[model samples]
Target: MKKQAYNPYLPSWEYIPDGEPYVFGDRIYVYGSHDRFRGNAYCLNDYVCWSAPVDDLGDWRYEGVIYPKVSDPLNKDGSMCLYAPDVTVGPDGRYYLYYVLDKVSIISVAVCEEPAGRYEFYGYVHYADGTRLGERKGDEPQFDPGVLTEGDTTYLYTGFCGVGDRSRSGPMVTVLGPDMLTIVEEPIFIAPSEPFSEGSSFIEHEFFEAPSIRKRGDTYYFIYSSIVMHELCYATSKSPTKGFVYGGVVSSNCDMHIHSYKPARKPMYYGSNNHGSIIEIKGQWYIFYHRHTDGTNFSRQGCAELIKFREDGSIIQPEMTSCGLNGGPLAGKGEYPAYLACNLFCKDEEIYTPLEVCGWTAGSLK
Candidate 1:
């Protein structure tokens, strides 16, 4: 009999969210922000990794801490927390990890010779004048970084805009040189923020944060978390940096917009901010996302669902399922944990889990 894979593919105790899955050679490695089991804040731990052979999605092995919070000079005392990150293999055949500190607006870079090895601090993404990307006079603050390198050029996608915040324009893309730390082209807004989405295709689902980029054939898929917070949405463009049209939701943590089993507006599970991207493993495409757990938004676990792309290059939103990554339905007989329940809800049918239920405030624990 074959081993069956379940949702929250990692061990139950692990809290790895904002997953960016990539297939480097024969293994698929997942890089994401590490969250504490029951922590007060988001991503309160160092960056760790987990990977598995391309042939087996069920056998995940811990890759240990690939990067530490204190490794960056700006976070010497480890006072700042590490946020969501993305990894790209550079032109030099080295792996580069891009991330931003919790309190800083600049994007930082770390490099390693191998995919899952310890990464050393490289530098901040800056300009020829030596000013960092976010430190420029009129530059927007850099947040979740999603990067893709083709040949010697890398497209860096980043931004964090809250609803009705005019200061933030939207998700922006910048071009980097071969070095991967210096900007070759200035930042340009690919989508509209909530405040500026009046007549745009992204009117209702304006870009919020967590911008990741992937290319399938000739189409560039830009995955992001919209202002809705619970769903991971996507945009498609022929070019890497411009003319992006809003696609539909890839997956929702609370199972919203799925009317096949229940009302479209009804949320079946506790939902919060969702982040992740799509990856193709062994010719199969899956969306890697996270879900709120431990009754709090801080502790998040990763989840993935099989996604299909239409001939026109559109993806239908996938429903949250307990038998994710299994490639098919589970066997008729087996033992499953209660946490694998994808349709979790109370009699009240609450869509979101409130922080008060977990005795957690914005920046402090009660």
Candidate 2:
């Protein structure tokens, strides 16, 4: 019998958040920032990868440490942490991983011949004048890079704007040339930040961080984490870098805005910052996201939910569930682990996980 996929698809001890999933060849590989279990900071470990056959979602194999923290030239001592990353196949058919260090504002590139193989430091994304993308004059700091390549052009999405911070604009997109490192087009803001979202459609859910891009048919889907911090929202546009209208919440870690089963305002679980994107597996679409675990925000676990679209191209947000990626309910009733509980709460009706107890502050992204 085939195995059933459950939430936290990887081993319970692993904490990989900000997942970017891609189907290359016959398997689907997941690349994201690795987090140390119960660590003091986020993404304290090296970059690791996990993959499974396209036909079996439950049979995941560890790809080991594909990229180490010391691999980058900037951090030879490995003091800096690796933030969220995204991968794309370059024009030369080599897999390119784009990431940003926790202490830097510039994006870094790593390349490998195979999808899940070891990656070497390629170069930093720079302009024709050799200035780094984010270090140049009047350039916004880049964070959480998400890339999509078509033909010889690649669109790189990146930005991080805190609430009421006027110094930083919203998420921006820069076009990369065939070399995958040189900037072909200047950076442009694609969405409004919290301080500048007064008259925009994204006033309620302005982009905070985690900008991921996915294209289906002629529509471009921009998935990001909003200012709320617990939900993953999406926006769509016909063009790659313009005219994006805020859609709706994709998945909330605490089930915040879902009214199908309970009150829309009541949170079902302890949630904090969320980051993930959507992907299609075997003709079915799903959203891959992470949830806080071990009573702390540093240790997070990944989860997925089946997503459906209306004829108008709008997606209804899915509630947090235990039967994730199973395609439906479990077949037979049996004892399950308590960590699989989707609806977690105490008698006091606490909504969010206490960050102070975990030595985490409110506005700290890392």
Candidate with maximal lDDT: 1
lDDT per residue (tens digit) for residues 6-96 in model 1: 7888989999999999999999999999999889999999999999888888889999999999999999999999999999999999999
Global lDDT of each candidate: 0.91, 0.90
lDDT of 1: 0.91
* Candidate 2 global TM-score: 0.96
| lDDT of model 1, residue 199 | 86
- Estimate the overall C-alpha local distance difference test score of candidate 2: 0.90
State in Å the error of residue 114, model 2: 0.7
Expressed as tens digits, the lDDT of each residue in 274-327 for candidate 2 is 999999888988899999888888998888888999898989898888777887
Structural RMSD, model 1: 4.2
Q: List the residue pairs that clash in candidate 2.
A: none
